[model samples]
Target: MRKKRIIKPLMTRLFREPHFEEMTNEDEMDLKKQDISRSYHQNLETFKSIYSIPKNTDIKLREFTVRSLNRRAFIIYIGTMVDIKNIQEGIVEKLIQSQQPSSKIQDIVSYPIEKTASNIGDIIGFINGGITALFVDGDSTCYLFETTKTRGRSIEKSINEVLVKGAKEAFNEKVIDNIALIRKKIKNENLIVESQTITKRSKNDIFLVYQKDLVNNELLQEVKDRLDSIDSDKVLELSILEQYLEERPKSLFPTILYTERPDRAAAFIEEGHVVLLMPNSPSCLVLPATFWALMHSPEDHYMRVPYGNFIRLLRFLAVFVAAFTSAIYIAITNYHVGMIPPDLLMAIAGTRERVPFPSIVEILMMELAFELIREAGLRVPSPIGPTIGIVGALILGQAAVQANIISPIVIIVIAVSGLSSFIIADVSMNFAIRLTRFLFIFSAGFLGIYGASALFIVGLFYLVSLKSFGTPYFAPMTPYNFSAKDLLIRHVPIKEKLRPGYLKPKDMVRQRKG
Candidate 1:
């Protein structure tokens, strides 16, 4: 008996699935690798099989005879994605009504053909991007027509980065419109918008907007290399792509500046900075961001020198108040009560006489409550959000004081800290400040003033050491590069002449020395 005595299991079958699994994967790969056929019938059937036509209702395939040429033709597109009017009027109607027998397909069609593709893979990509593809009998190439339906809200006023003196318009979700907005600001021929496909599977495109004449080639290539190195199958937004491009993902401080204002993006481009734009993201990413950039508002430059500098000073003060108020209170009350005047000390002691918790515990409890109120304010419905925040804080604080769970002085400390944090407009910087506030509070609790001071020094060192795309985080300030002195304050617009020296821009002079 040949094999009846001992039938052993195959190692391949025992370790994995049958060989048919490999064949199935190869078949799927072959579908994508196949070339477009010259025969209209064969191309039609292949697409139908690949897209699973009957099972997939949205993949529309319309077959018809081109009466003018006396040839068979077909158009395929996503039903929901393409414009029905463009398909019916621009393509089908124009193709069938052609009077000249010698007319080419491009000449006969009323709509402009965007591109022609001979590969099945490229043709499918065009169709998937809301484009209509036309194939005729005996023709290997497919004509692509742009029939993508524009679906998004119209441009609206700036909401998050609201400015009283600057442009009221903000970027919408449409990338074309966003590009248009930037173009509207910078009409120079050197303003280049280069597009690249960064992902493998999803094929999402990112537009890099910069002035070719001004942007340093090395810097631009470095940015391009980082973007090209992303191996993700899908990256849907600029926000998600920002994380991929960031060198320090876990750092509390943001290395990129995100802005919804096209004017801001345009200004950065003028300064030889690269601005990244993507679809579905209302904001654009400005790379090689500095600490001052994140802290700045567009309105700072929009206003007069004195007014702008005044607000800047206030904002500067607010940052410290927000980050240090709770920690200072914790340090003084817990470890060094002598720092307070006699009257203030007696008042604080009197307020805490009825309270049962230590200074740190009381401050932490109030801070947690304030954070909860602020978070709830953001998450609740728009109509009732402010109401919930106001009423919730009032009731919670009053009840806590009445119940002797927290001191009135601690409430004042936490309230000042919370209010100061709101003065910071940038969301990322605000979060970093608030989080650092907690760290300082814990440090001060452990070792009083010395701990907070030590933490501050360490943080300063970290900030100075951090780099965004090879540019120092605290550039044009520490390790001093010649800038317009626009870091903490603003000079008159006419006096501000230099592009940031640390950027090492190709053109250092913004406005030639007048």
Candidate 2:
């Protein structure tokens, strides 16, 4: 009926050839796109242009002919990035001696030397990655051979996290070797390893490893999301990634854990946590770390239950002495002299009679000097490191006391505090302890025992409020769970039948009664 209103369609060109301008623009766009050229010469020219082969002497492009078929081909690779022996024996020798010139690339390259990549970007990436690319005259694709040359230390004893009874092996700079070390410890098929390039310039590789069946899906997803959110051009070490992944960058207490031993990393992976590794990093990062976990050591599990509990109790006492000793000294002298025994007070007063500065100033001066000596010892060569500590502490303390700059009691207090810090096995927690000790010292200097007590309460509150990847940092203790027995005390291994309940692991039962 509306055919009466059959007006001619305004834009009725249903089929027509594309305009010359449109076709030309499309062609130009295709040319600008990065893709491998079918022409061998074109591809070669592209590589030379991108890599500046003529000016960059490290890039070696060798052209040759297949002797049997008289076909042309070329191989491009970075000389320093690849092993010369492997290039000669594995690639060059095999290519020259091959009689099947017309065979498929796979057959030509052989197993373990797979061929991959046809795009220009990928080809260049492979070349820079120490892989050799062979471009045949008639083939449209390029063949890549793996010849990466990674230089690192052989498996060595753990340097930082020493253990009395455990494997001596530690992770090295080579990530592949580290993965092998982990796989050797964990032979289960569920140990999943996923890797991705985190930086564009260096193309640094980062690996996330965990148990597939044992890991919590949400925890794994959170880790992956945090990793993906990093948009930096360079991440050289796991420490940098740790900083990026940490929720509270400004907090003195670390939420993530770092360890150099593979056995410890494997143990964390088995506990439904994730482990991260990168090249040039001799340690791995363990996520969702708890206070109790950081305080425990591998040697604890190795010892008998009673002996382990004794060591744990001693460590607890040491932490208290390290953190509160100096603050208590300052507090007692400045605010609570009556709290000290009369004879001891008289001796302390006599010792400080000639000192020129107040208790706070004397304590800070010695603490600052000790920190400087510690830093210098760390920076100096191993041969002289211990010497620096002994000379700097003993000689300097004697000189300070003799000069009447600081009393003898101040030196003893600082030394004891420094020594007690070493009992905490985890370096991160030790650092936190050191920082908290300073805070306590200042608090005591200002308000004596009252100030120290208040600050201690506030610090406890902060610890309880903090979360590491959705898990409470100070769990099992603050939340009043039955699991507090394992917090500061080491129970018999047979009596502990469950994993940490706060983690909400998919598999919670660690063991069963005999």
Candidate that scores best on TM-score? 1
Query: Candidates' TM-scores?
Result: 0.94, 0.90
For each candidate in the order shown, give its overall lDDT on alpha carbons: 0.87, 0.81
Superposed Cα RMSD, model 1: 6.3
Candidate 2 residue runs with Cα over 4 Å from true position: 1-33, 67-70, 480-485
lDDT string for model 1 (1-514, tens) is: 4221221122222124423233244454545555676877767766766576767898898888887889999999999877898789989998788777754897788899998998777787778778999999988789999999868989999888888898899999989899999999999999999999899778898999999889988889999999999999899998899899999999999999999999999988988899999987899999779999999999999998899999898999999999999999999998999989999999999999988888989988989999999999899899998999999999999999999999888888999899999989998899999999999999999999999999999999999989999999999897799877789988888888999988888989889866
Instruction: Tell me how far the alpha carbon of residue 279 in candidate 2 is from the true structure, in angstroms, after superposition.
Output: 1.0
Where does candidate 1 have its weakest 10-residue lDDT segment? Answer: 3-12
lDDT of 2 by residue, 398-509 (tens): 9999999999999999999998998998888899999899999999999999999999999988998888998888776766554325777777877777767776678877
Best by lDDT: 1
| Residue 250, candidate 2: alpha-carbon lDDT | 90
The pairs that clash in candidate 1 are none
